[model samples]
Target: MKLKHILIGVGVLLALILVLKFTGVIGGEKTEKVTVEAAGNKKVVETVTASGKIQPETEVKLSSEVSGEVTELLVKEGDVVKKGQLLCKVRPDILQSGYERAVASYNSQKATVASTQQQLIQNQANFANASATYKRNVELYNKKVISASEFDAAKAAYLTAQANLASAKENVTGAKFGLEQSGANVKEAGANLARTTIYSPVDGVVSKLSIELGDRILGTSQMAGTEIMRISNLSSMEVNVDVNENDINRVNVGDSATIEVDAFADKKFKGIVTEIASSSTSVGTASTSVDQVTNFSVKVRILADSYSSVKGGAKDLPSPFRPGLSATVDIESESLTSLAVPIQAIFTGDKEKSPSQAATATNDQSQDKQKAKLNDKNIKQYVYLFDSKASTVKKAEVTTGIQDDQYIIVKTGLKAGQEIVSGPYSAIQNKLKDGLKVEKTTKDKLFSADGKN
Candidate 1:
């Protein structure tokens, strides 16, 4: 009976040990190891992305100041023109008549001024003669050579002549002023008449022609027809983009940027920030409301010209880009020269497995400044280092610095040319540890896993 009890106890002990071994609680088992090496420094560029449109930097809209019928159109949509070049002409009959009438009016005023000046000169001469006679009569009256009434009459005559001379001088001055005003009116009319022949105000390409020959163009006014044609300097262009309110604070003038046009997908252009709006507002089309957008406008100067042509060995653009082409732009705000890692490497939770159990571990230094890690903290980061003896993996906690959307700088705990575990975290989590053995997949295996050759 005692021997039998002892045998049963031994059997139970063996069974318990077998269960523990199967559950991996008391014995080691072979695991696919993750080999790792140290990672070196990498250059990281932080950028902000935005959608924008290409536009001409300078656009001039030519319009008629004087109303007239268009008799001829000298330029087309793609024609390049110089400043003050004849663009189009209108019927000159009415303008010519008005100009002639203005000239005649000015000449009449001039004649009137001349006649008034001659009358003023005659009045002055008469006043001088009357004064001399008055002086002679006064002397004679004092000497009793003439009567007192005669001397008084001569003095009155001299005073009347002086008043006449003053009136004539004032008339001459008024006539001269009238003549000058008439001349100015004539010049203004002449200028308006000349304006009927439309001229290019800037050196640019003819972007638009609103009217053809025989179409009457109305005068430029606030309520009436204003635009007749448009000319733009297309040698250099600009990109205007509205950045969201959330990202506006991160943008500034003179930041380096890149632009890609939808029309020209193969080419990428460079630009620089030139202006930033001080205010914010919501903008959208009729189909989309997009309320609470609160976007601010930013203007970028493109470094590449749309046309790369030369005239007489001098580098110049053939034509500037059109005003309304869509573009995708990336503004580089910051860059670092030290170590960088993918943003995915920084994890905020160890929900799958606890950090303590993992062979290759990530020390969470972000928890307590003094302690290497705290179990309660959620934020976690991992990097694998080479395990030389066992040909396996080890992990460490790394402090992080500035980051963009794609990459982040590793402030501490990383070096260059070391292989770190980049993927397959779930498969290797339980078996990870310092100095554990590991095996790495080849590039062909990784590619083939995705069903790619």
Candidate 2:
């Protein structure tokens, strides 16, 4: 009786286990699967990716023409100023004093000229009087009515007067020349003084101001000094990017580009390839110091119409885009009217595989197996098409064209309207066959393989 009870208990436990397995309380195999259909459509696109910043193409920097202490800053940074507007003023006191001294000297020279003219007239009058006396004396002597000594004395007096007149005329000429020299000095001093007041060179906003009140500015000379300010046209902008030697050939004038600034997160502006540097402009650095690596600068111009759209009006972008703000850009080098798929879809057979594990098979057999493995479908890029009537997958060979990271253009051997398997490749690898019958499984049946109902 005890043995029979034990046997009955074992049978009951087995029965319960079977029941649990059937109810999905235990693991089991999945019978059905779910599938997605592939649809073909034309995707028109022109896209590329680059990085750059928005900037004023004609950024006018306001710098001092002459060195002086900064006496007054007329405008602060971000002040919208017009062309020829006074933005700042260097200390003009010294310049003014110099100019005044120059004027005084000029006046003094003018007075000297007048005095010289008066002296020249007086000298001429005295010479004339002496000549008249000499003439009278000569007449008296010639008529024998006066002594020879008196005539001689009159002649000596006339000669002395003539010498004095010549000397006076020379002094007058020297004084006049001195006056002209003083006048020129005055004009030069005035020009230097005018240079002290800094002015806006263009119709732009004051983007920068390097001086506060009392900042000494070293004028233009061998040792260039600090700048007063920078003015830029807020409306106009440009981007400069360095193109690699490999890509420089593709980049040309008049190509299209897109720009995005980090400051303005939601904005995208259109630009054009306006200028490409003819000569290479690359400064070598430590990392790039390795011989033979080189790059060239390329400048792009922003289209006004596109900028307006990006700003969402004409006023959003800050005047003279702040330098050092990060930006991204994309230049369209080429485009084609063709069908494309994700680059991940195309797999190359060139990828190397890890060594296989030890098997029941020997070295010679393993070598043979490895040789056969070369012909495996792991490498060749293939697309599986769904045969609607047969309900099976068909392999299609393909040729490919240009690929940007996201998508690749299909060159040939794949037609539109044909559904291709995009996933579950491993599961269907051997079980799937051409003209084989199939039906998509429901969600419940699909997860059944993992023991979930």
Best by TM-score: 1
Per lDDT, the best of the predicted structures is: 1
Model 2 residue pairs with clashes: 33-441, 50-329, 51-329, 67-219
**Count of backbone clashes, every candidate in sequence:** 12, 4
Give each model's whole-structure lDDT.
Answer: 0.72, 0.67
- Score candidate 1 by TM-score against the native: 0.72
Give lDDT tens digits, candidate 2, residues 1-453.
999999999999999999989986677543324253453544433444556655677777656667778777788777888777876777788779999999999999999999999999999999999999999998899999999998899999999999999999998999989999999999999888888876766787766677788888888745555777777776767887767665677787899988877777777778888888776655534444456556677777767776554433325345325655667778877777667654433433432232233323453554344334322445455555666666666666676655453455666767766665543322333334444445554435545653653
Give candidate 1 misplaced runs (Cα > 4 Å): 1-37, 92-95, 221-225, 278-291, 305-321, 349-399, 412-421, 424-453
User: What's the CA error at residue 99 for candidate 1, in Å?
Assistant: 2.7
Query: Per-residue lDDT of 236-306 in model 1, one digit per residue for the tens?
Result: 78899988776788888999998887876677778899988887644344453646467888888888542
